[model samples]
Target: MSAPRPPAPPAKASGLRRHRALLARLAGGPAPEAVILGDSLAAGWPGPDLEAATGCPTLNLGLPGDRVQTTRWRLAALAAFAIRPRLAVTMVGTNSFADGDGETRVIAGLAALLAALRAAWAPPVIVLATVPWRESPPGRSEADRLALNAALADLADREALLLLDCDAALGPDHAAGLEADRLHLNACGYAALSGALAALVRGA
Candidate 1:
């Protein structure tokens, strides 16, 4: 068997509290006008510019290493928080593309996530933020990356979900998106995607 992980650290125990505090502030009270639920990109805080740009309380409920399945599984947790907002933003599953899952599988996972969101809360808008770019390893190429991203765009269209393409915003080829690790975002990259996302929400 694998080694057991250590007990939850203090920060870990208080993590939800921290997240709640942060979100509570963003929400502007017991209820928020909008909430953005996504992956690491969403969790990166997306800068204060978005809040000013949209003029709405935007909560980023993103966590690191969150796959599409985990996001749905965790939705119930958010339900317990008791704040209903007009909109919820969802961005997930770039990891699926990296781990050898095909575009079809990734889109299926995304579809399931959307279904869960639909069942849980009633929001006027559910913006399906398009999966951003981070280069895949050995067997993946730029074309493959483009293909999967393109597939997500199409899926969003068919579902009538708003598409916020971080890849396109970062650059057509994601050339401007990632840091040296080929994953995660630098400040510039984060700003790039957040700028587009903020603009999308503001205009919407």
Candidate 2:
């Protein structure tokens, strides 16, 4: 079967309107010490947990159903606010796999997203979290996920970005940390992820 097409970009006017309040806050609010970007996983991360982990304010810019292209668009909109963060973390690409995108395309997309992030925020340090495990969807498998993550590691090295392996954070018993659908993280998963992320930020 042909690979499923990537997600289409949202209309500019509506997209901007949807995030207007957030943009306003980013523009006006005190600069966050760290900013998290990506899809639902990023959005669902508890703010309290993150703050407690990093010992500072953090802004999460994750949106449900976001793909690499759409995320790039979000970054473009956010550029206007000039939100300067000390550290940035991103966890995306599972949705792309669900969309049936191949590893090459996903990696290229991530590289672009990383470039956009650096150009826009220029954070002192950037963290690229490996795509977490999920139940094998049609046209995807565990092997595919591992291959993509391996590529991501190389990408991080090439880009000089720190790579955070989600599996390592979740530990060997990661299944316990996943939701029933096995796609998104449960509270336990988030706890471990946030703790690892915070440690990285502190050390970076």
Candidate 3:
């Protein structure tokens, strides 16, 4: 047998407290208006800027290097807080996209992740398309990423979840949206993303 899986990290106490305070102020107005949930990409999003852009209280529940499986596992922590968001935006699986992880597995994990989120959180989940990455080893290529997005589109349809493309904000090509490293977003990139996502959140 392989090594036992380590325990998942605890939710940030400050974040939970912030959520609770925000929830209390709202008096059951969906606690958090919007929650951005996913890996580093989601983490990089400017939460304050997004709130300003969308005119909603936004919570960032993103953890770096989170795979679909990790996201699924963390649902317990999210649910433990007993906070509900009107909209939850997620963009994950870019790190898990690799030759070793077959396309089928990636799709299944995504599907399961969405299902878990639907069950755990409230309605109006905005599933973000995985963004482009630099030509890094063990990561999926542009073509593969496109394929994954295609599959995700189908998954969104099947589950009746709202699907949005991150590329619109990031840029048409990888070079345009990505920073020098070609993965993370720069200030400009974040602005673009904030605009795109905010529009979606506002139903604009």
Each model's lDDT comes to 0.66, 0.81, 0.65
Arranged by lDDT with the best first, the candidates are 2, 1, 3
- Candidate 2 wrongly placed segments (more than 4 Å): 1-18
Q: What TM-score quantifies how close candidate 1 is to the native fold?
A: 0.77
Error of 1 at 86 (Å): 1.9
Give a tens-digit lDDT track for model 3, residues 74-178: 665566556667777777777667434545677777776677677777645554555455555464466777777787777777877666666655665656767
| Candidate with the greatest lDDT versus the true structure | 2
Best by TM-score: 2
Q: Tell me the number of clashing residue pairs for each predicted model.
A: 0, 0, 0
Better of 2 and 3 by TM-score: 2
Pick the winner on lDDT between candidates 1 and 2. Answer: 2
- lDDT per residue (tens digit) for residues 1-204 in model 2: 233334356445654565666677787788888888887788788899977766778988877777777777778888776777888888888888887788888888888788888888899788998988888889888999999899889989999888888999999887888999898999999999888887877787
Residue pairs with clashing backbones, model 1:
none
Superposed by TM-score, candidate 2 places the C-alpha of residue 156 at a distance from the truth, in angstroms, of: 1.0
- Model 1 CA lDDT for position 134: 69
